[model samples]
Target: NYCTPYLGYPYYSSHDEMIHNLYHNDDCMPMRGFYRWHIQDPICFDEDLKVTIQQIGVGYRGLFERQDDVASVAYWYQAEPHNRFPKLPDKEERWPR
Candidate 1:
């Protein structure tokens, strides 16, 4: 399970479950995604966790799933073992008013 399962918010604990729920079900998705660097960046609960990360997507039941402003992150598969990266801190560390 990846999601921490805190607060009243509901989340899939496993990667497969999360992906299945997000893509297979309309009731569960167009789910919101955010970064929590100060606390945690949504790490996987599994002991053999390697690439710890959370993924978010956009789209709703209609043509446009999300009706309001939302945040997102993108990852491009650049040539393996390359240096130089962009600076993107956790949602809180970057900006907050």
Candidate 2:
């Protein structure tokens, strides 16, 4: 979602202006915003296969020449074997809008 960092309609414009996504310190990292859903069971990606397994990551949105630092966390609960991750897109394709 880093390409469209803002979470909703009201906050969309704020991202382009850096109104809410700013760095207070050079060494510190900002917390990734997330949503909560109250339900009887864990979240599922597909209706046919109700499970909690999902993939998540983070990114930074900026101009073509602006190369900023980004950090993220990855947690695993299931013991399923994994496949290789895809190669990252080129710089031009990664430009944030």
The lDDT leader among the candidates is: 1
> Which lDDT tens digits does candidate 2 get at residues 21-78?
3563333434344433324454444224423333444437533342334333333345
**After superposing candidate 1, which stretches have Cα over 4 Å from the reference?**
1-67, 84-93
Clashing pairs in 2: none
TM-score for each prediction? 0.21, 0.24
Candidates' RMSD to native? 15.5, 14.0
What's the true lDDT of residue 65 in model 2? Answer: 42
Residue lDDT tens for model 1, 1-97: 1445342334432233444556654553344443334233544352343443343445464343334445545333346787687788898886835
**Per-residue lDDT of 13 in model 2:** 24
Error of 1 at 1 (Å): 25
Candidate 2 Cα RMSD (Å): 14.0
| RMSD (CA, angstroms), candidate 1 | 15.5
